[model samples]
Target: MENKSKPKYKLILDAAVEVIAENGYHHSQVSKIAKKAGVADGTIYLYFKNKEDILVSLFEEKMGQFVSKIKDEIEQIDEADQKLYKLIEMHFQQLSEDPDLAIVTQLELRQSNKRLRLKINEVLKGYLTLMDDILHEGMKDGTFQDQLNVKLVRQVLFGTLDEVVTNWVMKEQRYNLVKQAKEVHYLIYNGLRKHN
Candidate 1:
């Protein structure tokens, strides 16, 4: 009788996160990941075509859910402020909920080589476009300041959230990230909202 091969892609990814987190991206090896996954070295190649595929798949699987949740929140809310607040809250909440993903994204993933970095950037653009829509809606409704640069403001907003989450993750996940949502939103809104 032939033995069936289990689906090990997810196992490999979870193992990859631990390996990458412990060793850093440059130092992580496929053999190490396979061993951690409890599979033979060649098994990883069957699931992921290569190392880059693994990284990109990991980003897509993780961030895809993130983008979808935020998109759903955006659909339910009418006010831009509410949407922005929800975005920050959910963003921090997700990171806090999954420390492994936080470590992978905040630490190991950024260590990808230049070409892979560009690919990761491409995946990130989809998330940023969601932010851009919120900014655009705010401007259209006269809620946001007229002089705000849409693209730059989006960068600042994402950058701030990114830094906040990274700090919380790197600090041994001791911080209350979701609780800071209001303050972070207030800081961003104070800069972008129109003066009365």
Candidate 2:
């Protein structure tokens, strides 16, 4: 027999994403998600404790895999520039390929209250750590300025890519996000002025 439990859980999660995206976190109801999932409301509780659990688990499930894959990729590359470019490209490519997840991740997930937001932050530390590693590697090899604040640089890198993705999502995902990765990396690492 098939492992029916797994699919049910995924269905509920997918429905939650849709409902939350359509209604915003404050207005999303378990009943709404249940209807979308084609399951009874009680079924959600079988897999998740509550709405907050649903959001937390959703992020953990998706981002855990994302961070793991990137970590593996970075391990295979020694050059900081290559690692950074790969990170940015993979991030945008993943979102661009799946518009549903992109919407859920870029917009709906952030609508949670302050407490839930803190939990999400805790989960995001892994991705930030990956950025820090790249910046540290660049500094060690003299590819980047050693005087740069690693923390600030990490924030800038992540913040800029996040803004770019958000703009793409907001614009109905009509543009090519991956195509901009080269320009983004150049601006962050080399700046725009012609070399003397």
Candidate 3:
């Protein structure tokens, strides 16, 4: 059996993120990433199949952790209303802390082909499912509007966050993104919550 926990795998992944984020995906070369990882060029092949594999794997690895962390945080909140806030808080906080990952996720990743975009969307379903779970719980508990179109609400919530973070990333990360969490929460909360 192969050891999947090798530190070099993570090093290569991290280096790929930085290299791709700095140079658009089309411009990022395997040798560049390998050098950045401080490993031989041939070593990258031991972990990933090719450049496309690295890009897809990067999304899976990073977004997998992102979803897992947010899920853990959301599970701890008793009220559905508070869970929504925690969800938003963790999303912003995670990307804010890792600017390179943010750039890769928000900007570089989108530059791939339609087929790749579809694969990325498949990975995104995990986060979307988490939001659906929250919205359903909120409705059940009367925290959010009972008549809310669950699908639309989920898109609205995720779409708003996507836009805000993309804007922040495009602007060169000049402002504090996590600080916008409370404001964003209130905006979405007022729209979805029953009492308003």
Candidate 4:
């Protein structure tokens, strides 16, 4: 198994986030990240194939943490609506709490090459799968219309959240991103609700 929490790996991951966040993805160098992590430059190659690999791994590691958190949080809630609200809240709160992460994810990640984008997308399937679970649950319980297109709804839900976060990142995060969680939940709820 890949040991993400090993001290050196964790240090390299954290240092990569800081380095990429401060320098932007293109300007970020492996040597700089190694220097920040107090490791030899070759240490990065041991964990990742290249700079692109580091960026992809950073996203995988960060998003994987949030996905795990969301899964744990969602498991406690019975209602699909409640689960969706928690999801939105956690999504916003995580990015809001870490401004550097917000920059790295929303801004720097978008500037990556095509191969990197695909790799990131592959890692993102887990988050999308989680969203699909909520949509399926809603339909099962009659909270959402049975005839609703789950794939499209997934896009709407994911796209709406992505757009909102991107806008916040672009504005330099001057306002509360997490504060929009409730309203975002409401809007998405209305869109998927059977009775709406």
Candidate 5:
């Protein structure tokens, strides 16, 4: 297997995202990804076991970076509310910047089988954990209601963002997605905020 740190691995993953987005995962072939990556078809197998592995690895690598970037950006801010806003903004901004990724993640990936979906969910846990941390921080700082249910709030937060992106993708990204981040943040923030 090729070392994942190699530039070729990223090239394969990025090409996979574009290919899968263009042709649904079931329709996308290893040769297609290899060609896009400018590598031999055999080289794909050096980094992934199969198409399923590629899909799972793609999610793992992309979501890992997504969560890390958001975590780093939010860490610089002190307030939980602003952190939440930044989280929403970054989520939208990143997806909007990479429309192919948005299509693969939001639409194409959902067509996978039960097992693949579960594997994708495993990769999603890191992102969920980031959201959980933000929620817990808000509660601890008295910015959010102490009585808030962290788990439920986390699901709601993720669901809201996921739905927004899915809608944007489904609509062919006609409108500006990042612009809606503020309203999303406002809805989620008000739901969890402590009321006088």
Candidate 6:
């Protein structure tokens, strides 16, 4: 594998996001990605084994940065509720800022085969675990309901954000996605709060 720390690796990955977003996963070719990256086609092979590897690596690299940023932002907040709100807000904000990435992640990547899907899921675990950490913190601090099921709540929370973003992408992003973060946070926060 090529050294991931190299600038060319990131170039190819970013280019893959663009190519795949425009041409789709099945139609996106290494040559196209390489051209978009301004690298020779052989350069991609040095970094990735195949097109499938590129897709998986793209998800891993991007999602790693995604989760890391969210984690860093949320770590400064003392309240779990605010942390969760930041999570939702950042999720919408990041995707909204990069329409190509939103299209690649929310649409193109989903079209991959089952094996690739599973690999993508593996990369998602870090983000899911971050959510779980927030949920557990809320429960421990008496913010969220004590009876909350962490796993199920995590799934619901992820699904809510995922579906909302997917819908926004599907709708051609005519509306501002980040604008909905407040209501989404409100609904989720109210649902998870401890009852009086």
Clashing pairs in 1: none
Local distance difference test, candidate 6? 0.95
Query: Candidate 6, after superposition: displacement of residue 134 in Å?
Result: 0.7
What's the residue-level lDDT of 182 in candidate 2? 91
| Model 2: per-residue Cα lDDT over 47-92, one tens digit each | 8888888888878877888899888988999888889989998899
- Residue 108 Cα positional deviation in candidate 1, in Å, after optimal superposition: 1.5
After superposition, candidate 1 runs with Cα above 4 Å error:
1-7
Q: How much lDDT does each candidate structure score? A: 0.86, 0.84, 0.92, 0.91, 0.94, 0.95
Stretches of candidate 3 above 4 Å error? 1-3
CA error at residue 91 for candidate 2, angstroms: 0.9
Tens digits of lDDT, candidate 1, 80-165: 98899999999999888878778889988877788998988988988999999999999999899877889999999999999998
Instruction: After the best TM-score superposition of candidate 4, give how far the Cα of residue 188 lies from its true spot, in angstroms.
Output: 1.0
- TM-score per candidate: 0.90, 0.88, 0.96, 0.95, 0.98, 0.98
lDDT of 6 at 139: 96
> Could you tell me which residue pairs clash in candidate 5?
none
lDDT of 4 by residue, 77-185 (tens): 9999999999999999999988889889998998988888999999999999999999999999999889988999999999999999999988989999999999999
* Candidate 4: Cα lDDT at 125: 99
Minimal lDDT window, size 10, model 2? 187-196
Model 6 worst lDDT run, 10 consecutive residues: 104-113
Q: State the weakest 10-residue window (summed lDDT) of model 4.
A: 1-10
Ranking by lDDT: 6, 5, 3, 4, 1, 2
Model 2: per-residue Cα lDDT at residue 61: 76
Q: Give me the displacement of residue 55 in model 4, in angstroms.
A: 0.8
lDDT of 6 by residue, 48-119 (tens): 999999999989999999999999999899999999999999999999999999999999888889999999
Could you give me the TM-score of model 1 versus the true structure?
A: 0.90
Better of 2 and 6 by TM-score: 6
Q: How many backbone clashes does candidate 6 have?
A: 0
Stretches of candidate 6 exceeding 4 Å from the true structure: none
Runs of candidate 4 with Cα error greater than 4 angstroms are: 1-3
